[model samples]
Target: MTETQIWALVFVALTFSVYIYIAWRSRVRETRGFFVAEQNVPAIANGAAVAADWMSAASFISMAGLIAFLGSDGSVYLMGWTGGYVLLALLLAPYLRKWGKFTVPEFVGDRFSETVRSVAAVVAIIVSFTYVVGQMAGGGIVFSRFLEIPQAGGVAIAAAVIFTYAVFGGMKGITWTQVAQYTVMIVAYLIPAWAVAHTITGIPVPQVSFGRILEELNALQAEFGLDQYTQAFTARPQLDVFLVTMALMIGTAGLPHVIIRFYTTKSVRGSRWSALWALVFIALLYTTAPAVGAFTKFNLLQGVQGQPVDALPQWVQNWQATGLVSVSESADTITSITNKATVFADGGADLLVNNDILVLASPEIAGLPAPIVGLVAAGGLAAAMSTAAGLLLVISSSVSHDLYFRYVDHHASEARRLGVSRIAMGLAVLVAIYFGINPPAFVAQVVAFAFGLAASTFFPLLVLGVFWKRTNAAGAVSGMLAGLAFTGSYMIHTLEVFGTSAHEYVFGISPEGIGTLGAVVNLVVTIVVSLATRPPSHEVQEMVEQIRYPAEREEVGAN
Candidate 1:
């Protein structure tokens, strides 16, 4: 085995060891310990945990890749994801903690009705399931490249590791696991960026130090005629880009996995603090990613735009072996010359470049040595695996705690409830693996779909259900169902037709841009339905009031 191979194995072992250690320490026998970390998590620590868990495989791998390849348009993810959580802090976090349920669907059931709760529960599963597969795919990619495992084998191993930590550690395990993951992923992402930026522009953190990068990049663009995506929006002078950002921002606040993090803190103050900390953690990686991406893109053009095909770099050869990169082959002399060419004349140089390699390739592009590149592979895996575990915990709890305990056995013993939760968690991991192996042809594209779906379906439901008491069960149900149906159908159309690339489908309404419109549909349906139906019972109104202000009442407690 190669030295880089050994380093990769050592890195994985070190990360897994920490998770095993935390799991042993944080293991809980009761349902409370398993699902909610006993609600004793400190604010800053929980924020760090939330940030670690929420910034998954896609963020680590694709965020920079998108920025580098797509140029400024990639900023949409940076703004949408980070800005969305601001809404989570301002609007959702405190109230949910006060309502104090073990799971999000539990709160939905309580606020609206059993029906609304069940519907929300199902929707949560869809969003989480679709997104988790992306994480699993990332894990497989990491193992396939770094550890030399077959892609299928690597994915299964990831499933097994996620199962071990998530099922046994529960939220408690996932929380601390994420703490470790955050460390591995952020360090992995930032160090190379620091080195590259310093070498190129004499800055460590690229986001704050954009002054130099901007100057260098503009010089390159001016000399080379580099067409950037962000320039398109700026040149056109329109609000289409603005609307897409709003959809991502609103949708992020509504993601179930992210919201559940707030519930771990001990107090409302803790909740707010956690959001701030999480932002700091997220920003550390976020700021550097775009600069890394842009630099990588700039370098790629300079190196390959007119290079001979047979002279492709060794790194490209390694990437092709992993199937992450694909190319069309030809032998005609001029066509051979055309085949050798990297960048195309009109635009879009290489369709062969995987959207997932930006982070992994940053070290090499900057001419960093072998060991640092190996470290990046490990970091990518940490991002993917840590997120898979957190997602599994939620899916498991949805089944074992919320569905089984709430509906199947209202009087089941605590041990019995915990047992069922474990079983459900086991089953969910298997299903996630299944999806990973036979992932729908559009797995990558589904990342946008998950964000769009979450923003559309759940954000509105959670907001009105908590803050607006007059939103009767009928309205709540209608709003959620309408969002789910409209978005689901649109998503099916998106997947069936578009695969992954963005297009001007029906007046520039791309899948990523549809959530706001979906939320609007949900809101309209909810209002119309609420007016059409009887007001919620006085008891339900009282429940909404209780959730709106959780910090005040220590009276009833978690019965």
Candidate 2:
């Protein structure tokens, strides 16, 4: 095997072995343990696990790429996701933790009616499945590029590994494994970024050097007659950027897998603390992403623009083998004895570099050592696998715990429930694998769709359910259905799915941003319908008050 491949194999084996060991050590048998890690995880460890779970392949592998391609517009993801986490911690996490349910659907069931619970459960499943497909696609990318395997083969292998640890170890195992993953991915991400920053600008700190790099990149882009590197709204409309940012922010607050992390903590305060810790850890990478994006883009332009096809860098040739990148001779291929002005613009057109490969190829592009390249490959896999495990667990719990056990057999034994969860997880893996092999969009884009769905369908219900006591079953159900229908239909219409051509976006909102409008629609419908219908039962109202203020439960009981 090649040096990069060998190093990658070694790193991958070591990391996978560590994950399996953690899963084995932390395996659970009971339902509580499976669903919420027995609610005994310490705040710091749970924080790390939460970070690992939240920063999936999209964050680790694709976010920088998005930034690289979209320029300043990509700041929306960084801002929306970070801001959304704040919203979740302040607005939802503490209250959800106080509610102390095994799953989101369980909270809905207790707060509303059985019918609403079922609907929430189905919605949770759909959102989780949609999210998992992105993770699988990302993992597939890492495997395909590093392991020299086909994307489909890579996806199947990732599915089997996820099934092994996630199904057998459940939430308990997934939490500990995620902690390790966070460590791996962060270290892997920072090392290359630091090296590249130092190499380019003599500053090892990416956050500091990226500013200098951006100036250089803008000059280079201008010379090539391309849009400036710091330009915004060039790739997407201004309205879409705002709506997409809002959708991602609210959606982060609403994702089932992320919300469920709070339930794994010992107390509501633990959940809050964990959220704070997760933000700190996540910020480490988010802060560095722009630096990495600028550095990689500058490197690509400088290294490849005027290079001969036969004399291209080994890294470019290597990636080209994967068919994600391509270079072709243009009419001016033989007349390339020119300055930078004529290269990117007039001579041979630029190489078709896929954004998804930017981060993975950055180390190689910068001529970093093989070990760093392999470490990045391993880190990408960790990011993808860690999030995929969390998502799969969410799907399993929603289906088995919320739908089957709650609806099918109230008296089902723990063992039987666990069996059903494993089977559901296996089935979910199959579905994820299929979609992974045939993803509808890029990793970050597909994930954005998931966030949109979550924002529209669950954010309004959860917020209104906790903060507004008068939100009855009718209002909750109506709001969820309306929001989901609107968002789902918009996405289906705007996205080229199932061989259908995309229609014009409504009001200039792209599929990625439509969820914000859908959420608005949901909130309006929910308020109007709640006012029209009778308020919830006195008991349910009391329950809502208790969720909002735990001390009130004892006061109400005494009264």
The segments of candidate 1 whose C-alpha lies over 4 angstroms from its true place after superposition are: 215-226, 234-240, 331-351, 441-444, 497-504, 553-559
Model 1 TM-score, 2 decimals:
0.91
Clashing pairs in 1: 251-455
Model 1 lDDT per residue over 289-350, tens place: 78888777666555554456776666667777876664445311111111112343333334
After superposition of all CA atoms, the RMSD between model 1 and the true structure is 4.0
For model 1, state the Cα shift of residue 319 in Å. Answer: 1.0
Per-model TM-score, in order, reads: 0.91, 0.95
RMSD of model 2 against the true structure: 3.5
Compared with the true structure, what per-residue lDDT tens digits does model 2 show for residues 22-120?
888987899889899999999999989998999999999888877887788888888988888898888888888888979998899998899999999
